[model samples]
Target: MQQLLVVGDIHGFPETFVELLDVGSFEQRVLQLADLSGRPGLRGDNLHDHLVKKDGLQHAVRALRETNGPPCFGIGFSSGGTALWSAVKEGLEIQALICVSSTRLRFETSPLNIPTIVFWGDLDPHRPTEIWNDAVPECCKTYAGKHHDFYRVDALAPNSPLRTDIGAFIESVSGLHSGGPAPAR
Candidate 1:
């Protein structure tokens, strides 16, 4: 598999995000890029232009396009998640996408066919389960926590279902050899 780019949140500290990569066993396969602006974690407006500027996605595509490795699989949370989507919308072409708590995606229908997974909390105040259900249907994974609970903290649990599922998804996507567009999940 190629490098795993952990796009830190605009509000997230670079140090904390690096720690998260270490805990997730992804530190070894990282794509070190320019310093990310803003804080880490989700807070709506606080993250957006500061975290992923309008051309950030395009920049990542150009930067990684010449890399000597297989396609990348991105894991984003909250605002980071939506930014990844925007990147895909801008034709970033990641191998796979796993997003959690990217609220307000119920209105986005830009024809994403990648091997995508969208996690929905049972008690999310932002987007309801039905919304995610209607959006990805077969690709959505439902968790037993609130919106905030879907953060990397929940993923840190050794026996967490979210962690296991993410591992499996990454493995599966990494093995893909066809350069064709990802099929619907």
Candidate 2:
């Protein structure tokens, strides 16, 4: 029951955020660099580069579904939140969802009955807090801060409250972890 965490829309952030990942860091950066070098990486292109990470997330989810261990918690950031919501709606067994700076991709009656936490940077260029605040269900909580504030880089040091807020939210909702063993894909 290892909970599979699926991250969302990293875009080109991986190119410089190599220090974040503990595993597959180099390879992931190389792939992102390759994708950025080509025209396919442009926003909304829906090209081969997009599918690369898309496949990766899907594979990760499939593996988590197959695992039979401690109940796992899944966290999705930014566009990753969108994907997480999709998985939950599709009936993918997950303990929880932590979406940051993102929203639902389409308008549908979501089947996501699980506890969901949303972290939106107040000043994010794309997914601002106002856009997602009312859109998400009450079960989901949105943090008001700045874009990339979660990473705590110098650019966002002024709005460091987001980091602490996220930590607190996780602690508050962790007790609600539930659902049976993740189902097979």
Model 1 over residues 44-109: C-alpha lDDT tens digits? Answer: 344455334555434544544443545667766665566666666666667778776766456576
What local distance difference test score does each model get? 0.55, 0.43
Supply the TM-score for candidate 2: 0.52
Candidate 2 worst ten-residue window by lDDT: 21-30
lDDT of 1 at 176: 37
Q: Model 1 clash pairs?
A: 10-38, 10-39, 11-39, 11-40, 12-39, 12-40
What C-alpha lDDT, on a 0 to 100 scale, does residue 141 get in candidate 2?
Answer: 39
Candidate 2, pairs of clashing residues: 1-68, 1-69, 3-72, 7-80, 8-79, 8-80, 9-80, 122-145
Give me the runs in candidate 2 sitting further than 4 Å from their true place.
1-8, 12-70, 104-111, 128-132, 139-145, 148-160, 176-185
Give candidate 1's error at residue 1 in angstroms: 4.1
Judge candidate 2 at residue 37 and give its lDDT: 25
